[model samples]
Every structure is written in structure tokens, then in C-alpha cells.
Target chain A: MLYLALGRGAWGELLAKVKVAAIQARPVGGDFRHPGNIRHALELLDECFRMDDEVQVACFPEYFPWSGGDELARKAEDLGMYVIAGLAEEEGGALYNSCVLIGPDGAILGRQRKLNLGLMERKHFGFSPGRELHVFDTDFGRVGIGVCVDFWGPPNVGRELARMGADLIFNPSFFFIFREVWHCLLLARAVELMVPIVAVDVAEFPFRLGDKVFESCGGLSCIIGPPWRDLDDFASWWYEPKFNWILGQLGYEEGILIRELDLDLARELRGAWFSRLLGREAPWP
Target chain B: MLYLALGRGAWGELLAKVKVAAIQARPVGGDFRHPGNIRHALELLDECFRMDDEVQVACFPEYFPWSGGDELARKAEDLGMYVIAGLAEEEGGALYNSCVLIGPDGAILGRQRKLNLGLMERKHFGFSPGRELHVFDTDFGRVGIGVCVDFWGPPNVGRELARMGADLIFNPSFFFIFREVWHCLLLARAVELMVPIVAVDVAEFPFRLGDKVFESCGGLSCIIGPPWRDLDDFASWWYEPKFNWILGQLGYEEGILIRELDLDLARELRGAWFSRLLGREAPWP
Candidate 1:
């Protein structure tokens, strides 16, 4: 079992502030097997890097490409940033929906396979579900990744990650429809886990096979922090419009959203609200 | 351990449609021990019953009254309606934050003491938390109640109720602050549990103790149903202005919200989305 690294080492000290980006990409023209899909993903990654030089980490939509993992790692190494990208992998004759975490050193730090499978992934694509959850240690802080439906599962992969000492969670989803539902679910997860969430989905995707045509993934990448209020005036924190702390959000268009998150604020709010229920000590610490 | 009654019997056959009401009341002048608080709650109940004659079940906010359980039961029996009301209870020398269910026969069918407690409730009020989760079989269907923070808990009492065969869940909340957070959590619970949630909070409450003048418990009582889309076109469901199926929602004012929920639609969507993950057979069935 891969648990979160909880020791008060350099990582703990580095949990001050980090700039994160969620990249909303246009759908690749071809399927996962096509080289065009990988090329398109690389192009989007390049755009994200060019858009924000201060982004310490960038996340892409799910099922971008597994073949592009090494290339993404190399880019991360060159830019000195962490990269979380989604792809489908073939391991031991079984296909799995996965996301790869590449560190600043351009090393594949870890991979999180999707635990819950949709009907299309299971019956149409023959993808096997994942069995384990892992939290990765990074230069900035401990992070966890839940690919798409894993965040929607009743078992709550995000809550488990927070319990393991993850200050941040990244959800790479292909929400396709019901965009409002996606937003509501992400906010709920953030509040329950008492952590920050960077969830990205494809802006627009058109699936055409035989006589069927499916379009509109509704790309609305957003970043949500823990619920907080003004310490002195509790009423002002909720009534005042300025206290609405959705750091950044993107509309249904191909773009990259960058925001500097105050990890200290999230920590303070978590302590005030959830420390009693979740406990104060970090498991690994 | 209590599980949802899932067998296909007369109850299953009766799961077609039910009219429900969520009453958003203004805070009574006195605390739980005051007669004015009970009078205010009874008045609100009268108004709700008058507003919707066909409503089979009605829900009230948390801490509405402590002395009206018997009266509320008698009223429910007279009207032939199920009533779920929130109040504080003193039992065996312990104070509990609780909600009571009154059957159509005017009997106190069951009570759900809150399982989670906040700082004010635990420290200032010296209230002890409840230790059990239950689902009640009513004339309409299986229903569960979670007072305030239990709906916000990570374990998700709402999901447990849905698993226990509850077609509907009532969340009696006194969400004094963070109104948007309340909306997000309610929508998230509805989507995750695949069940309708009728969450009621005080319309507006002003507390004046010494120099502290605490005002505003924004009332935005709402009823949310299962996530659904048009079978012909998926994009139409989200993009169409009329597709937002929040039956009704109130602003920051005292009012009653009534909606007719199609349980058959919820059951269909649950079978389509959650059955694969949660399993088709109910444990109790």
C-alpha cells in the first residue's frame, strides 16, 4: 500500500504557496491509438507552459495518451515543474485508465489508475479497474490523484488521500455532460476532504463512431479550497461577496487556468473545522 | 445494523410520485425552552400544511422546537402526512441534537439524533452526539434524517440511507453561515447518493447576546433530484435553459418550497449509474 509521506521534512516546510494550472484541451481528432492524439496533447502542454511560467504543476484531461508520459516527464524536467497527465495504459494484457505524475526531475513519480469504470470503458473498451490508491511525494507537498469517476465513487478516494496527509488532490476527468454536476461534486469533495482540488476536463469532444455522434464534454476546469470564514466576523465571511474563494475557473473553451494557492490558509481552515473529526497528527509524521 | 428495505413489494409498487414540502422558518425569539419557540414552529407547520394540501411529507429546520414532538405528531395524523422536525432533546440526563419522525397515525415513529457535533453545540450547549444511523419505513417510502453536520460528514449518512433503501433523505440544517457552501454540499450529496434531498434551514435568524449581534441564517431551502438528461440529445439537457431541474429554491426569506418528485425517474437513473458500483441487490432485501 502506498501511503502519503507524513514526516516533517523539507516537503513540510515547502507547503507555503504553490502555483498550479489546470489545462483544458480540445479533443484530439483520433482515438488513443492514433499518433495525432499524443501530438495534440503535447501541443496543449506547450501552450500551458507558455501561458504561465510560474505554474509549478499542470494537469491535463483524462485519456490524453500513455505514450506521451516520457515526453511529458522530459518537459517537466526541462521546465523544473511537476506534470500530471491522464492516459490509458496496457499492462500485462489488461487495459487500464491511468494518470501519471512526473516530478520536477522528469521522473515518473507515480501513477493512479481509475478505480471506478464507466460503461463505455468497461464494455466498449475492455478496461480493468484499479485496486490500490497512492499518494505521491513532491517538492512542493504531498499530492493525490483520482482519475475521473474515482472522485465520484462512494468509497471516497479523495477523503482517504486527505487522511494520508495529502494537502492537494488532482482529479483528471472527462465529464462530457452535466457540467454543473461536476462543479457541485468537486466543491463537495474539497469541503469534505478539507483540501484543495484541481479538476480539469476536456473543453469539447466529439465522438463519432458508425451511426452515433456524441459531442460536448463541457470543459470547466476549477480550483476549490477549504471552506473558510473571517475569524473576527463570522457573518461577513459568508455574506460578503469578496470572501467567495474559488481561486480561478475556466469556461467551456480551450485554455489554461493558473492560480497561486495559499496552503497555509487551507491548513488553518482545516484545523478550525475538521481537525477534531479527522485528528491533528499527520499519519506519516 | 440497519439496512434499506429493498425487496420489490407493495412499497416498491407505491414508489411513483410524492409531494413534499420544506418549510423555511424565521428563528423564534426564545431558545428551545421558551413557549414562543414552540408556538412559532406550530404556526409554520400550519402555514406549510395550508400551502400544499397534497404534500405527503413536510420537513422543518433544526432547533425549531423542543416541546412540539407530540403536537407535531398529532397534526401529522390529522392531516394524514408524515412530518420530520428538528429539535433539541433531553434524554437520560444527556442533551441531544435530534429530529423526530411523526407518522400519519400521529405517532412518533422514530427519532434521529445528530451523529456529528460542531464546537458551539458540543462546548457551549454541552450536547452529546448520537451513536446510531437509521432509516424509517413510512407510508410514502423509506426515509432518513440527518440533522445539520451529519450530511456534511465524510462518511455520508445520506449515502448510507440510500443504500438502506431510502428513496428520499431530509437534512434539517441550521446553517447560520456559508450559504453557498450549503448549496454545494446539498447538490453533491444528491448526485452522489442518487436520491432526492430536502434540506431546510432557518430563513433568517438574529441572535443578540450582550454586545454580540449575530444576524442572518440565509434560508435557501431546496429539493434536488437525480441527474438526468434527454435521451435524444445529451447536450440539450445541460445547455437548455429549462433543463435546470432544481424544482424550487428560496432566497434569504421565510417561505415554503413544494415540489412533486418522480421517484420512478430517480430509481431509473440509480439503476443506470450507481447499480454497477453499489450493487443491484440491497443487503436487507
Candidate 2:
């Protein structure tokens, strides 16, 4: 029972005219993972803070050296915008795909382990499904996190997250050229949540994940919400995704994908006008 | 108001199976139409009687003949099906897509033209919107007819038909591949009618229309109602679309797909199930 919606944005087929803040990620050895350790990762975090002083959150591509979780959680305190980046987790000689949300105070806010494992993902990295959705409270608002395939399950994951009090949902994705199904799923999730579900697909850099190196995953760093409240004022509104500098093919080089949050719309729209059809009673828990 | 409902058979893939007494249609040259010409079309009623004897009625595809409608609906009788088919009226050299229904007695039962159309369709053949949907009486029960795409517009076509007095509805559709969006509309129509609807897709021989062949238009024919049904002994316990004689795979060749229908169940589940939902108002017309 929360107020939420998404700002739908177009994806990049080719780069164009906007300036963007890009989070250039480098590999740290995956072998250096611990539940709570960080030295070199912290140094890397210092570089991220220095590069974008106003960055609220910096994202990383999937399957990078993810051992920096606890460290990013701490680094978020200094970075101020918080940190949500992907990392390959090492546990008991096995690897798991995971994304962590580090709080502005550098605390571990939430974690969502990838649920749908590709054949190679399951083989090279033994990933077990994440059991529950993660929605945490922050001074900014209630935020939720979900990895790629976790968003695809038919039983309404996005709606569930919205119902769990998420004002913002961060979806860090790695898209592919032959893949059209996932794009539709992302749009459906945004419509279902009716909140700003920022889906950041990797761009430019190609890295090998098994036999393939994906050079361009395409970028559609969108701010999805219901139709803009004032069509005339759309260009100037802070909540309007078009106004977010982090969007557009050209804008996201290294600037923050920023937008102000309004927590009330998710609350009032539930019953006053359009009934929550997604919340209709069904034969499930 | 007349009671009406729209129904379709499942997976009416063309010529996939050989049907025992399936109706085969050949594209005719002259104008073929039926509008308010009940006794006129019923003249060849005995031909259907000679072929199948107890056929009750047979259906044809949408716009079976290239008829000229402005000329007092010329060639209203040559429409092939005991049940009339959709027609494209050639006027001012422009085309108006339509569907007309004839009976086993060769009477014009009713005709409903399609209203909503897509871009490609609008470009190729012009269509006039169907303003209303109504049902008429028959020996079997109150029945109605609606063309393809008519169901897509608010589904009020079926609802209005049901409200008018249709216990059964015949919806003959023509499309290369079965669209899921149409299926969703069918599901919604069945749920709303609380009556039986026999949806028969225009299953026929593939040939050329203009540049398109008439017989080569592979069709999927079906008869869907309550997926399960219990009827009076005189009433058929089950209907089967076992006509598997579709040959050659232009990929559209699937034969008659029939399934027994249970109208009573529509009343049971979608109807007044005696104090269901803790006494909410009846949802159907």
C-alpha cells in the first residue's frame, strides 16, 4: 500500500547530445571477498567520490569484482549519494551474483541476489535464488532493490515491492542485442510499480562473461512515473524524468541521474481513483 | 436489447486436420452480400441440408466475397455460408469491410461490421465503423453476430449482444496468425456473457485476394464455451473441432478446431453464483 509509479524513458540505439556522469568500473580480484573487509576497494570508492562530488548513487555492471560490498556500504557515508553496484560474491569457493545498496551513512541498506541463473552463471558461479525482495527505509524515502530476472517472475514482483513501501526501485541490468523479452519485462515492471524504477543498462565497455564480451548493452536510464502531471510544465518539473540530467544518450557520461522524490502520490492513488487491480485478491499469500 | 456473446474455437490452425463434414469455401467473382435480405439468402437453404442434413447452420470467413454494398447491397445471396460472412463493400472504388450472417433456413440472422481497425488494415482496405451491436431470435436460441476487431473495442459488442438477448454469438475472424490480444478479448467476452458463444475463426482454403489468394488464407476454426459442460441429453455433451484435413504448410493451414461448450458454467462462475463474493453486484449484463 504505497504510492509509486515509473518514468518511462527511451533506450539508446546511438549516442547523442547530452552530458552524463559515467561510473567507470575497474576489476578488483574476486578472490579478495569477505563478509566485511575493504582496503583497495575503499581507495577506489575515494576515486568515485572525487570524480562526482554530487553523485547520489553510482552503479556498476553485473559480475564485476563484487567483494567490495561491505566496503561500498562504508564508502557511501563519504560519497553521500549512497552506492548500489553489482559484484560477484565469493562464498565457500562458490560465486553468487549480487547487488548491494550502501547507505549514505555507509551502512548496508539492502541486498538482492540474482534469482534467474544463466547456465554459465550457475556453473562458473553457483548462485542460489534470493528468497525475499529487499525494501529499506532511508531519509530520502523507502527504496527497493531487485536484480534482472527477479523482476520477470509472473507473480508480480514489482507490485509486491511497491506494496512493501518502496518509493524508488533500482534495477541494475545487463541487456543484450538479441534480447527483446527483457526490455518488455522492464517496461511492464515500471508500469506495475507506478514509481521511478531506474533501470540502468550497461553501455560501451565490453567484458567477457563466459564466451561472450558484450560491448554495448544499450542505455535507457529512465525515470518512469505516471504521465507527467502537467504536460505544459513537464520540461521544468524536478520529478519529471525529462528534466533528469542523468537520462538521454549524451547526458550520462559522469553526471548523477538525479530527480526529486514525492512520496505522497503512491499513497493517495491506491483507492481514490483507479483501483489497485494488481492488489486484487488472488489465491496466493 | 438483445442477448449476445462472442465465442471462438481453440487454435483453429488451417488444414492441420481433416474434418469429416467441414465447409470448404471458394472465392466467388461477383458481389456477395446479405443485409436485411433474410428470405433472399435462405433460398439455397436445402444445399446445406443436402450436404450435412443436420448441420443446423454453417459459417464462412470475414469478407468472403468482394461485394458492392451501395447497390442495394448487391449479391446478398452468393455469400457461401449458411451463415453469412464479412464483406468488403466496393464503393466510389473504396472498400468498406463488413460481415453478414445467414441461417440454416438461409435467412439473414444478423450482420455486424467491424469498428476498430489498425493502421496496416486501414491503409489496405477502408472500413466503416459499426455503430451498434444487437441480437436477434432464432430456432436454437437468441443469437448475434460480430466481425473481427469488433470485440477489441471495449468488448461492449458482446456485452450489448448479451443484454439484447443473445444466448449464442458467432464471431468469424480473419487474420494470418492468431493474436493473443484477441484471445484476451475472447476470454473477457466469455466471462461477461453468462451465455454460450461459439467463436468460429474463418477457416478456409488459401487463395489470392487481389494479390492475395482466396483458398491459401489458412484459417483456424474453433468452438469454445465452458471448457467443460454438462447439457441435456438432446443437447450435445461435448463439441469437438477434430477436422484435421488441413494440407500444405503455408504455416496458416490448420483445420477445424472444435471443443464442446458448457453454457451453464458461464452462469455458475461469472453469473449469480448464489451469494458469491460476499454479495457484490452482478458483474454481467
Alpha-carbon deviation at A195 in model 1, angstroms: 0.9
Q: Can you list the residue pairs that collide in candidate 1?
A: A6-A285, A176-A217, B4-B164, B4-B165
Evaluated with TM-score, which candidate comes out highest? Answer: 1
TM-score per prediction, in order, is 0.84, 0.44
Worst 10 residues of 1 chain A by lDDT: A276-285
Interface RMSD of 2: 17.3
Q: What's model 1's overall lDDT?
A: 0.71
Candidate-wise lDDT, in order: 0.71, 0.45
Tens-place lDDT per residue, model 2, B1-285, is 112232212332211111112222333322233343323223323344455444444555466533422321322233322354556755466565666655433455556766555433564455545555666554334557766645422345665776675556666666543332334345444433444544444344443335543343434444545432332321221121121211111123333332333333444543442122112224322
Once superposed on the true structure, which residue ranges of model 2 sit more than 4 Å away at CA? A1-55, A91-94, A152-155, A176-183, A209-218, A230-256, A266-285, B1-285
Docking quality band of candidate 2, CAPRI definitions: incorrect
Separate DockQ for every predicted complex: 0.30, 0.04
